[model samples]
Structures are given as structure tokens and as C-alpha cells.
Target: MASVCINEALTDDELRSVLSKLEEERDKEMFGLVCKRWLRLQSTERKRLAARAGPHMLQKMASRFSRLLELDLSQSVSRSFYPGVTDSDLSVVADGFKSLRVLLLQNCKGISDRGLVSIGRGLPSLQSLDISYCRKLTDKGLSAVAEGCQDLRSLHMSGCRFVTDGVLKALSKNCANLEELVLQGCSNITDHGLADLVSGCRRIQHLDLNKCNNVGDDGISKVSQACSYSLKKLKLLDCYKVGDQSILSLAKFCKNLETLIIGGCRDISNDSVISLAIACRNSLKNLRMDWCLNISDSSLSHIFSECRNLEGLDVGCCEEITDAAFQGLGSMETKLPLKFLKISNCPKITVTGLGLLLGKCDSLEYIDVRSCLHVTKLACDEAGLQFPECCKVNFTGSLNEPDLL
Candidate 1:
């Protein structure tokens, strides 16, 4: 693409808006070469260009793009493109972007707490920060965010191994309006820290504790106990330590629960599933229990009986379930409000059994029956005859899946 030449008379605000959309570093560099007028405007527009383009191009306009509001250096454009953004990059980032609100430095292995603290010192308007996969980030970096970023609402710190109970305590005390929190793959937080935090952050709505293997029933129970009324969205994916007891507590307390995703939790039994269905029957809109080994057809029926407003359901790889689940589903004439349904890799589902759901469930827009050997093309053809709203379908290694898209 040719360089976009701008009129010299255009105001500064107009120039900034045009420059913000440029995704490539080469485009910004070529803009200067296009004309003398453009060359002079490049100095003021450099920050907009540098923040959007990968950190590799930050050096080209390091001194200029100092007042950037949003900095997303999650991935280097190319191996040769990102020019090793070290601790030096932090100083330029802090000095330039005084109004920086959203900063995403994901997968930037070289960045540490020192660079992050510089951000806290520089930007008081920082609200949303994501430092996922930055293993070197310790309690110091988290403390800086809690103390410095007074308006912080969303914080994602997945795999920051050094973040401990102290960081949680600081966040609970300092960041009172915190609404969304993602602490996936972090092992440092314990029950004591989490218990204190849930009691403090009464406004927490969305929480993801995926793969935080260190958290046991004590921590999950504490969260369920403290934030049951406030918590609307919760994701406990791959939380191995979670069990029936913790789930039971959540089902009883969380009244306005909209979404509950608990995939790969091996300890969750049929009793927990029954309790969740029975307790949150009216409020539950979406429930995903993929790979929960102990769950069976009985719990699936429990969901059908209770959760009337379910929109999305994923019961993938629940091997113990047979045709009885679908039979129970087809027996009723009630059109499920489900938009997304996935029962992939269930060997027990035969052609007749699986066909019942596709035919009976009319509101389904997306379906996934991947790796079910017994399902045949004729069966799918017959099922698709009744429901035509399905826009997307998946058949991962299934022998006969004619309805699949």
C-alpha cells in the first residue's frame, strides 16, 4: 500500500485519529518519506503508531509516542520486527503515555517487575492491565498496580509464578472497585489470601481461576461463601482441587449466577451436579461440564428439569452417559433455548440416540459431535431435516456426519 499523505492544514486531533489505525511500522516510516509536510506531522503521530505496532517499532518513535493511552505489545509482529524491548522500553512508555489506561505486555519474556513498577509510577489512569505469561512478574509488580493504578478494574496475571498471598491482600485493600480478575496458572495464592480478598472486593462480578492447581476446597469454599451474592460469572477450568462440596456451596449461595464453566474438574461427582441443577435451576443460563468423569445421564436430566433458561450447554466426553440422556431430552416438546451444544467424543451415543437431540433441539445454532463412532450420515440427515438454524457444526473424526458444516 502507498503511503497516506495528509493535508498540512488538518488539525492535530484529526491527524491523531488518522494515525491511530496504522497497524504496521513500515507505513508510519514511509509516511515521513512521502512529503515534507507529512514528515513534520510524523513527530506528533509517532506515539499512536508505536503503540499499535509491535514493541519492535517502539524504538523508531520512542521519544515521540510518549503520550499513548493504550499499549498492546502482546506479541512481536515477527522475529526480526520486535527489537528486544527491555527495561529501557519501560522508561519511554512511562514518560510518553501519562494517560495510559490499558497495557497488555503478554509473552514479553524480558519484562519484569522493575519495568512494570515504572508503569505504575508513570500512569495513574491505568485501568485494564494484562501481563499474562510473564513468569518473572513477582509481588512487586502486582503491588505497584494495586498502589499506583487507582482506577484499575480489570487485571489478568496468568502464570506470574511469584505473585503470592501478599499481592491478593494488597489488591483487596487498595483496588476496591475491581470488577474482573483472572489469576489462571498462578500457584502462589492460598485459601487465607483469597478469603480475605473476597470479603473486601464485594463488587467482583467476573472471576477466572483456571489451572490454579494450588487452590483446594478451602479457597473455593471461601470464594463461594464470600462473593455468592455478587459473583455472576465464574470459570474454574482445570481447577483440580475443586470437588463436590465446593460446587454444592456455590450452587446454594450464588443466586444470580448467569454463567458457570467448570471443565476438567475431575473431583466433581454426580451429587455436585445434582445440587448445582437443583439449587440454581432458575438462574443458570449456561453450564459447561466437559470431561467431568463422574457426571452421568442422571445429572443431564437434572439440568433439563431445572435450568429452563439455558442458552449454551457442553457435556462433551462424559463417557458414562448413554442414549438415555437424549431419550430424556426428546421425550419433552419444550424447545430448548440453547444456541451452542457440544457432546463430542462420547462413544456411548449411537446413531438413534444422538439424532434425537439434533431433531428435538430446534434453537441450536452450533453443534459439535466430534469423534462419536456410532453416529452415521443418514441419522444426521434426518436430524437436520427438523432444525435448519444450525449455522456451524463440527465432526472431529466422526465416520458419518452429513449435517456437519
Candidate 2:
């Protein structure tokens, strides 16, 4: 037939060219289904894959996808019923994917120090690794990765309770090019670990120390000073030991800080907030100060007035914040770029303040005024009806109107 003649006429290189032009995975897969030769070509060209982890499956993948760059074996979601990837499976990965650049094993509970040792010894080209919530991993395993994979750029070890200052020291000494580090809920790490980390890895741009209770002003101040120019996003949520000094240091040193999340740092007062608003006004975009008990109207006023580029603000649970904050926003000569606002659980904010903010900031995409004592459900319903379809407002627990019989 004509189709058979045309397929026979096309060279292997020409077939490969056609395959390269196909962008969709489904289309490429369809091309492979044409014949065994096309299927072989497709397997050779594949670079990334996500699959359920097992020693036999991984070995098969390794042999098929010779040029693979990324592998994701994260058992964080639906794979809870299955026994996750273990040290033996990791050894298969280490032997097969020596050129692998990214490996994500988040919440793979079966993987321990033994598994990581194979990863460290094998994948020297690794640039990003996420072992978050892998509770079995300890400092020994992480340090081995740091020592072996010097080109690492992003490392996320959130909820790895056993990781300590030893891994931090190893990272500082080895992975100088590290940029993004998340140690969220790694409760064992203290100021000493952070100091060791910043001493060498000064290029860190995004750092998360959320729930790191032992990390006080001293550790954060050191980070502010060391990675001042490069630091862009910082999260200090529920770090109760962090007070005004850390914020003040950030304001003074980290002029380019774009996103700051200091929620649950109750000791952060208006003075440091004001300074931060003024200092990082040009660069600061998203800020969350929820549960910051000491910051009030003055801090919010300065923030609204100075931070022209701020796109998100979360000042929830700050009992002192009142209508005065929104009044400042309404009075601005130019409309703020704020698209996300959360003022939930603030008893002092009323319908008047909500109205003022809504009237002025037409760009708002999301607003949460949940549990505001003075704002009625009727008022919220009215505001929702008047606002454009793009904006979403949450007014949960607001006073509902009495129904007529």
C-alpha cells in the first residue's frame, strides 16, 4: 500500500526529526506505537519519569531511559498502601542513573541512611534533591550527599527530624553553590548550625526556618548579614524565639527581601515592622505577619504607604489592627498592587474598613475577612455582589441576617 511504501522510504534520522517535532507526550507515545524501532527511539529520547518505586521497576527504567535526567519516586500521596522505595531500590538507581541531575524521594519512609549512601556514591551530577518528610534519614546520610554532590543547588529536608548541625557543616564545606534550602520543622537545628551554613553558602536566595524554635535573633541576623544581597524569600513561621532584633537586622541588611513570612513571631513590634516596610519598600512584595501580637495600625499604615509593589499581605490574628490600616490604603494617591489580603480574626476590623479597602483596591483577587467581629454577613454578601468576578472574598462566621417568615 502507499502508507507502507512512504514509511519504508523515510530514513531513521528523518523519523527521529519527526519525533523531535512532536511536543505532546501522547503524540510521541503514538509515534512509538507505529513499530518496535520507533518505540526504541522514544525510550532513548525520554529524559524524565515518575513511577512507583521498586528494585525491578527501577532497573528496567535505568536500562531503557539511558539519558534520563530526573526521577521522582515520591510516595507522599496515593502510594501510602504500598511498601515504599528501600535501600536496595536506591542501589539500583545509583548504579543505573549515574548522570541523574534531580531525584525526589519525598515521604519515601522506607529509605534510610543506607539508601542515601548509594545516592551519594553514585549521583555526582545531582543538582536538586527533595527528601522532605523522610523521617528515617539522619545527619549521616544527608552529610554524605552534601559531601558527594558538590553541584547541588536546591535541597529540601523539611520534617527530617534527625538532621542536625553535622549536615549543615558538611553542606557549608562542600556545596557552596547551594541557593534554596528548606529546613522547616527540623527542630534539632540551632543557631550554631545556621551560622555554620551561612559561613560558606552565602549565595542562598530562599531559606525556610519555619518551626525551628531554637533559632533566635542571632542566627537570622547572621543570615541577613551573610546572604544580604542574594536573599530574596525568608520564612520564620512559628519561630517564637525570633523577635524585633531579627526583623530590624533584616530591614537594615537585606534590602532586596521580596517575601517575608514571620507569622506566629509574637514579639515582633511596630518599630521593626515600620523599618522593614521603609527599608525593603521597593523590593518587598509579599508579607505575612499573622499572630504578631505587638504590631498594630502604625505598622500596617507604613506598609500600605511605602511598599508600593506589595502584592500579598496577611495580618491575621493581630488583635490590635483596626480600620485605620484600611483607611491608610484608601487614602493612598495611587492604588496598591495588593491582590491577596488576609485580615482574618482581627476583632477591630469592621465593615467600614472592609468597604474602604474594596473601594480603593480594584485589583484584589482574594480577600479573607473571616471571623471579623464587626463585619456582618449581609455586608459581605453585598460586597461580593458588587465586586468583579475575579475577586473572591471569605467572610466565614460573620453575623447572618434574621430571616422573615
Candidate 3:
């Protein structure tokens, strides 16, 4: 049977039902873009229908939206310019998505500061804003939001190279209620900006300053000293300036930390990891330390022995790790709280190292021992796949393990 169009004789409820079904079709964007009537009906009711529309379709849909509690437009990969797409298309997207509780316009290259200003206008209830990787965004555009949207609770400006400490100051002063901030790849930000924000925002729970090379011990010391009470999750990926002192400071003060990611922080040695794990061992749930070459068997052994409650861990490319350290993880008590584990390119991990974990940690649901060259088929079979997740295995020499449909 042919689908009933919204233009036909249909009540609002019937149109909504039809639109809901249309959303499931692969060409849902095309369905919304054919005419103004479809765009109007689809845009206003899109929260339930579509939240991940590509740029052109999103631009079209934004025309008729009057009220929205949240607007998430992150990770739109399509760069193909639709011939019909014009400046008016962008204007609609900016002007319509008003009163948003959360607005994520990350990676939208087409949107300049003008577009940002247009979007920020009249967004009185806007709380969470993620402009991460929007290269065109400048202080002027963001300042407008700081001056206007005072209720913002969380902000993600990662990869926003143009944004500087001025924006941070504005956010620290204006968005006082902010509880989460991600400043990854903002090379211009200094310790002053970081310290000011951390000291000011007492309610912050999660902070990601990954690849923020400028920040050193001075900045991190202030954050550790001040925001320890509420800071739960902190990611400092590739921040080379931060050393063991920062970790020690964090462990001493931020005892409530549940998730800590310190990937590519080469300045840290085994002592820092050991101290951090010891201090926050009882509370730490997820810990990732990828490419931290200085870490060795001693570090892992200490963390495993102490961080007994740890559930998720990733120690990728930590070449210094030795096989003996695996035994501490092997002795993990059952109910076996550890669920997720990733150990890639740790050369010493043969069947012996991995086998210990398989026999002991019965609750492990996700395991990535990829590139551990010595692991054979025999090891996999001996370590039974009784868990709810990742039951598929290649028992034979052939790596052709059939995926369960």
C-alpha cells in the first residue's frame, strides 16, 4: 500500500503517526525536505523522530521548530554540498533551535561565528553547549552566549582552536552553574584560565583537558587542591606538561575519582600511577593508560593488588609491562568485579598472562587482547566463553571465527 502523505486529509495525530513511520525509512531526510509542509510537521516533532540528521536535512527541519528542550547536532560526517542548500538553510537552523536545554553543534564547519550568534539568540533556557571542533567559532560568538545564556551547566569546546582564555574567563564568570567542561585541543588556553575555572566552578564533576599542552603542574595543582570534592571523572590525554606531581596531588585530594584517563601523559612514571591507584583504589571504576611507556610490571601489579574494586581498565602500548604483573589481575576475587579489559601490544603477554585472567575474572564481559602475538587457539578454548558478551571464538587454527547473527 502507498504511504499516506502529510499533505493529504490527515489530522495532527494521524500526521504525527505517519511522520513517525517515515522516520524509520532510510530516506527520512528526503521525506522531510520535499516541501515546506513536511518540513514544518517533521521539524517541530523531530525530538522523538530524528536527533542525528545530516547538515542539510537538519538545516531544513530547523525552519519550523519553535520550542525544543534539547538539540544535539554532533558528528555529522557528510561534507557534500547539497545544491539546494543556501545561506537561508543555515539561518533556519540557527534561528529555530531556541530554548534548548542542550545544544551540540560539534564538527559543523559550515557554521561561522555569525551562525553561532544566530543560534545563541533568545536561547534563554540553554544549559549544555558542545561547540567542539567548530574551527570558525571565535570569542565574539561565544561571548554572546556567556552574556546571554546564563543557565548553561556544561560546555564542550574541544578542538575549538580559535577559543582562548578570554572565553574561559567569560564562562567562569557567567556560567557559574557549569558542572562539566571539556577543553581538548584548545592550545591557546593557559594555566591561568584552567586554574580560574577549576577554582570558580565548585560543582564540576567531569573535566577533560586532553592535549592541552600548555597546562603544567601549577594549573593541575590548583584544580586538585580546589575541585577534589566533586571531581569524579578527569581525562588528561596527551597533556605532556603535567607530571607525577599532578597525579599525586589528584590522588591525595580527589579521592572520589571514579574514572581517570591519562593516555599519552609521558611525564608520569610508575610511582604516580601506584600512588593514584592506592589513593582512589576503592572508588576508581574505569582507568585508561595508553602509550605511557614508563609504566612497568611493578605499576600494574601494585594497582591490581590495591585497586580490587576496579571494573574497567585499558593499558594499551605500555611496552615496559612484563608478564609477571598479570598474576595480580589473575587472582581477582570472584563475583569477579572486573568486566572490561584492554591490553594491546604488551609484548610479554603470552597465553600464560592472558590465561590467568580468563580462569579467574569470571565476570569479564569485554576483553580485547588484540595483537598479543603469542595467544593461540588452545588458550581461548581453555578459557571458556560463558559470559553474556563476546561468546564467539575461533577454536581452530583458522582466525575465521563465525560471528553470531
Candidate 4:
């Protein structure tokens, strides 16, 4: 019955209107099969396409969607339904979509330096490229990108372990307009590489160095000095080599930061955190300090007193935080209220302190208190009853896996 209804003849305006409402790729594919006219109309309307098919499908799409602006050939690393795209497949896309602006080849295992070089030479108009998890890519592939795509703005090469200073130098020399660069898990990079990267990309606003173990205080200090003027978001998760000196530099130079994550940077203490609060008080909205066990109530007090606009706060595993920290947050006056709060595994936070803190944060929508030994069922019950119906409290005893901050 559904097929019969869809198969009925419709005018061009009616078909175009119906096609405009279909956004999902699967839905468009199904609609295209309704008739020859529908197939033609779908091809004309398609601008973004995501598929896990191999070379043949890439060739078909290249001809079908003449106006395609973005193409995502990424596939799940765990279980791809079809064979992954290869260098030959990428060459077909490069030849077809010469004006493509965005390309995402994340987790495409078959893609290598040759494929990337082919893409770089063919698609000079590409602006955003995400080759994250493409472990086969190295400096050679990136050098091709630098030589070809000068208008590039955003690039994500996370988990590409072979990347080093050479790749950074090439991109810095060419992609001057680059604003966002994600080097997460690219452990080959050292301080010198980071210094050169930031020096060249003065307009960079967002930088991610999560799990880049070699990037220490010196690298971060150089970043603060060079890109601080435009930098707004910085993530340094699990970079244990970084110390309070790095945070101090960021607090002093990158005062315009809106989001800051320092999870697993255990060397930071109350002094640097306090300075960070005072420096970015008006601009900071989100802060993550999980696993910074040395941070105590004094640091929390300083942050609450100065950074009233803060919306998201994660003090997970901060063993030294006590009731005083919550009280400090309750006393703060600000129009931008806290929306998300996570204090899981904080041994010093008791039921009394948790209740008091909950009563004050009227704007809070999500509260996570897992593994708080002092917080009992009574406290959880009271919290649920007191807060608005819109709020969701997670007081489960078990610890949830850590997520992105």
C-alpha cells in the first residue's frame, strides 16, 4: 500500500517539496528508487553524501551528484558493513569532485599516503578534512595537503601516530587560515613542533592535544604566547607532563578562553587554578579538572568567587574538595547559572554538603554524584524531591566511564 501511494504520479513542484523535507541519506536513497524522475530529482538535490561502499559506489556517486559539496567515506573501525575505501577509490572521488569543500575519511583503514596525496593534488578547494584514525598517513601525506590546499580551515588527524614536526611545519607554512587542529593521540609531536605550528597559525582558535604525552609545559607555554589572542578552547587531557607553569601561562596570556580542560594533568595545584579563575572569570563557561587530586576546597572557593558565569564544572576524583567548595559556589551571584555539575568520587563531599549545594543551583539540569560514599539514599531521595522536574540526578553507586569533557 505504501509503495503504491509513493508510486503515484506527482508534479515537479510537489516532488521537489517532498524531496526537500528528506534529510537523511537512507531516506533520500529510498526516495530516489520511487521512479526515474525521483532518482533524477534526488541527484540534483543531494549536496552531502555519507557511505561505506567501495570504489564502484564512489564512481557512481561522483557522476550522480554533480553538485556534491561534502562527501563522508568514513566507516566504523569495529565493524564495517562493506569493504573500506582505498587509494584507487579516493582517486575516483578526487577526479570527480574537484570543487568539493569538505571531506571526511575517518577510520578508512585502506587509505594511505598515496590516497591523501591524490586527494590533495586533485581537490585544491577542500576547506575541512578529517582523516582521523587514518594510521597509515604520515608527514608525506600531510606535506601534499600543505602544498595543495592553502584554503584549508579545519583538520582532524587524531590517532595518526606517525605525525611529527615535519607535518606541523608544512601545514603551518601553507594552511595559514587553519583555525581548528586536532592532534589527539599523535604522540610523535614534541614541543618544537607545537611552537612552530602555533607561530604560523596565529589565527588558530581551537587546539586539541589530548593524550599527546610528549607535549609538556614548554609546548603549551609556547601555544599560549603565540595563539592566546585568538584561542578560545583548549584541551590537554592526559598530558601528565604538563605542570602548573603551563596553566599559569594560559591564565596569564589566554584570558579570553571560554572552555578549558586539564583532566589528568596532576601537577596543577590550587595556586594555578585560582589564577586561572581570576584571569578568565568573565569569559570562562566550562571547566574540567577531573583526576587533579591535589585540588582542594581553596581552589574551588577562588573559582566560585570569581568565575560566576561558569556553566559546566567537573571536579571528578578531586579527593580534597569538601563542603566548603559547594558553599562557595552557592554564594556566588551570576546570571549565567551552572547547568551541568559532576562531583563523582569526591570522598570529602558529604550528604549535607551535597544537599546544600543542590538547593542553590536552581538552573542545574544534570548532576552526577556516583561513587560518593557519604551520599546515601536519603540524600538522593531528598535531592530528587527538592529539585525541579526538569533536573535529572544520577546518584548511582557505580562509576560511569569517563566521557569527553
Q: Please report the candidate that would top TM-score against the real structure.
A: 2
lDDT of 2 by residue, 139-233 (tens): 99999999889999999999999999889999999999999999999999999999999999999999999999989999999999999999999
Better of 3 and 4 by lDDT: 4
Q: After superposition, how far is residue 269 of candidate 4 from its true place, in Å?
A: 1.1
Q: Candidate 1 — which pairs collide? A: 47-65, 56-82, 56-83, 66-96, 66-97, 67-96
Which pairs clash in the backbone of model 4? none
Better of 1 and 2 by lDDT: 2
> Model 2 has how many clashing residue pairs?
0
Residue-pair clashes per candidate: 6, 0, 0, 0
By TM-score, rank the candidates, best first: 2, 4, 1, 3
lDDT of 1 by residue, 167-270 (tens): 88888888888888989888777778888788777678888888777777788788887888888788888878888888888887887878887888988988
**Residues 45-90, model 3: lDDT tens digits:** 7552235455566655555565556766555556423222222434
The deviation in Å at residue 89 for candidate 1 is: 1.2
Sort the candidates on lDDT, descending order: 2, 4, 1, 3
Better model by TM-score: candidate 1 vs candidate 2: 2
| TM-score of each prediction | 0.79, 0.93, 0.76, 0.88
